[model samples]
Target chain A: MNAFPPVPEMVAAVRSKRVAPDHFVTESLRRLEQHGGTLGAVLSLTKERAQADLAPLSARLAGGEDLPLAGVPIAIKDNICVRGTTTTCGSRILESYRPPYDATAVERLVRAGAVIVAKTNLDEFAMGSSTENSAFFPAKNPWDLARVPGGSSGGSASVVAAALVPAALGSETGGSVRQPAAFTGIAGLKPTYGRVSRYGLVAFGSSLDQIGTFARTAADAALIHAVIAGRDPRDATSSDHPVEPNQARSMDLKGLRVGIPKEGHDSAIDARIRARLSATQERLLAAGAVIRELSLPHAKYAIPTYYIVATAEASSNLARHDGMHCGVAAPPEKDLLHQYLRNRAQGFGAEVTRRILLGTFCLSSGYYDAYYERAMRVRSLLARDYRAAFEQVDVLLGPTTPTPAFKHGEKTSDPLQMYLADVLTAGANLAGVPALSIRAGHLTEGGSELPIGLQLTGPAWSENLLFRVGAAIESYWPEADRLPPFVRSQA
Target chain B: MIDENLVRSVAHLARIAIPEARVPGLAKELAHIVEYVDQLAALDVQGVAPLTHTNAGANVYREDEVAPSLPVEAVMALAPARSGNFYRVPKVIGDA
Candidate 1:
């Protein structure tokens, strides 16, 4: 059975006192205990912490205080700090480090009466496309235990898909949230850059990173988005642009101008997935939405540009984990420099080390102009592409990933093959646009049916419009209500 | 091509000690990624501006007021090694 009802239903029930807040927490904890280990979705459950805070929250709710996310049980990707909780970014280095403060989003979630029950896993420092790069363990897809739940937000995506949690917070540097959500057949939203605050979110590609939401449906994703997104003085990059709750009032697709980016439909995409995307477009057309073939000519460069810029920032941002102040340290050595090196070397996993090296090389003095600066110039061009395309249509549509989730160890050995997983989704991060990924279709591969997602990206801060379009697609998509095999077998 | 030596040097610069055996493999992987990213060189970026950040906001400043930070003990408690009120590190300017 699902642990809880949808966000709005649960919130209304809890707020109206018909359902006790503690009841959902109990169910969520039970589900986490049941499925978390099997799916490798949970790193640590904050059972004791969550229970201790519930009585007071229960009091607040009983007192008739209005909380938008009242009584909701949510999971946070381990990278985002929850005060006094272990904020491991899926690396052994800071495996046991507890943060002293809550991330701005976490602060908002708690203030709105949401209980953070667990910390989900991710690729180390959100570097790799697959959670297989997690220093501890890879999160498996609920659809097929043999396949990876697309990552670096794999853990968050997995738990939501398996009904371990109603909603989860995942950070996306490049396709982390959307890709994982796509692979897991859930709704994921990467809010426009600056639409959400990054304060206390462990920095990885500071310019590209945004705290995104994952849920079973786009409307639930929007509920979490509304609660968490807004300008935070702590995050200077956060915009003061007005943010209003974007809950879908109607699944109205009338006259919605959706642009089909020609680049997004490249031959590189899996033909099966493309067929699903076309079917979704047909659904939109049937609903009176206008569709146009548009061009984001520079879309192809998004992956390479995102890699350079993201890694460059990661290299600089990760410099703090020298083991001098916190995290795992090397054995005492006479040379401080060597000790620092050894501490980091031992703490970070292979993928983290690779990204750090790549980033360092990109930002190195001689190569800066050729690699990093040039990538930045190309990034500007990519952003311009979105700007121009948005002028032509309200949103750009495409397959979220080239294909469905793959078996573990399939792309692990080949780094390039793994990076390609984000090719279709990373453009939004590069352009700082908001993108929503919702399950549009499913394909039977290797005897198991895996979900495929369609991504709808809009111009910056246009999350409300994206949610509307996503809801329309979700309504038409037959597979949205289907349970993953893992959940089905258990039932 | 990224050579093993370059990989080692880059690791050192990044303050990570990579094993000598892993250097060759890392070098190969970095070379592959670098080569893939080299596609940017073909783009005509002559007139384009570098966008380091998407936020168009200028420097945001606040009043210089004393604010409470995490307690010193709380901050110190997180350190891997600490002596008194300072983080403890290996000898920097002393003989081994």
Candidate 2:
């Protein structure tokens, strides 16, 4: 029940039998009811409402409505709001909060006949690299239950990799989507900044956050991305550029130059992850992608710079959540001071509180220049390096993360270690490029199954090119549907 | 390195209360970040122009226009406390 049927297989199922949406939803619900809480991925399942919504779509399909996403069920991160459903951002403060309107991404899926199944958990406000910071529950890696699924999009990645959902929508403020995708062994793409509209997404580090998608394959990702991404008058940051067909890019990597950053190759990465990445390079070379070595001298500074800028922006965006006015309302005391203070003290979680403080410190008078300004300067150098690399090569290659997935709480004691874990993903965000993480290989024969991802970073709006190369690599070595033992046990 | 008091002060400014027990932990954690950032002082970036971290060459622009914002009432409605047209809140500054 948990094995991921390829996107074509699911579509064929819909087209061949005109699978009833109710029947499809019922089966998924049964799988979800038995398996969801254990994974800690699903926050709230819209069983009653989703079933009713699926009924009409089922009827339409039975009547021969050829909806592209007809009968397809998808999950969205809690940060991306779906109207009438709770969008908590995995914080206690937002637990009862519901968006008055749907996010552009949600609207796209709903309009395309996709069933809104559930809102998945995420790190509180997408601040942490791992989902352990979620106030509700930390999502466990589906592969090894003790391990993390990566984050702040951990729940989104876990559900897809575990085959609970075919695809999911996630957001990346640094490596939130890609890292989780890499850790959980799923296909994930972070579109160019402003390529996707920010309207209706709960804002956190607005300048850095881009809505990305996660799927079992690259083609499925492009299809979902094409549906949601485009210009919208609702969001000023949204580009007026016509939505280009990001799909249709085929397995053509011939004559493409893929750059391997000299610094990206670290001896510290797990040996198995390195083996998979090296093998992926061989496959790309076989397809005629010339691999070149380039140096980003300022790559070391990416982590600090990302945090400074991201957290500073996050501080400003989250300011509206003052308990006095927005989010969860506390008791009205006689004095405004007690009312606001008590509300805030009780509302925010430990992780959210810690970030707000760090962000506040960075943005405060007398220190902004030393921290925020300097960090901005550092970010520029990283971008400059990428620009130079792009002049010579079409894409850059590296391991998506230093390691695949770590046991939960291993890095919780030291936040710096956790921040450092994003070393590979942060540089791409700072460079403002379209980057993706795709599973390249597995380890340990039959008994022990470990997955590792190879990352590709391209110039802005070059996701189509990345897919071309991705499809080539995937073609050379067709990735089997690798599911965890837990799912198999259920079947 | 960041001291315990700085952590407490920052926490207060952010309106988040850290129990006394957690302050020591946060202070230790924050000190590592501050210590690592100090490495920048060793670099010789005297004359280099600050790079634009927003590396993408394309400036995704939309024609500027005035549009309807969230209805003032609806926005104010999200506020836990409101007074007339304004949101009610604790005085950020000292009371006169």
Q: By DockQ, who's the top model here?
A: 1
What C-alpha lDDT, on a 0 to 100 scale, does residue A184 get in candidate 2? Answer: 80
For model 2, how does the per-residue alpha-carbon lDDT over B1-96 read when each residue is reduced to its tens digit?
Answer: 478999888877776667789899888776777677656555665556654435334655656888666567755666666788797765556668
Instruction: Show what share of the native A-B interface contacts model 2 retains.
Output: 0.44
Give the per-residue lDDT digits (tens) of candidate 2, residues A135-194. Answer: 999998888888888999998888888888888999998899999988887889998877
Q: By TM-score, how accurate is candidate 2? A: 0.91
Cα miss at B33, model 1 (Å)?
Answer: 1.2
Q: For model 2, what is the error of residue A217's alpha carbon versus the real structure, in angstroms, after optimal superposition?
A: 0.7
lDDT of 1 by residue, A425-461 (tens): 8889988899999988688998988998999999888
- For candidate 2, what TM-score does chain B get against the true chain B? 0.65
Clashing pairs in 1: none
Q: Estimated TM-score per prediction? A: 0.98, 0.91
lDDT of each residue in B48-95, candidate 1, tens digit only = 999988878778888899988888888788887888998888888975
DockQ of each two-chain model: 0.83, 0.41
List the candidate 2 regions with Cα displacement exceeding 4 Å. Answer: A2-4, A15-17, A48-66, A326-328, A445-448, A476-480, B44-96
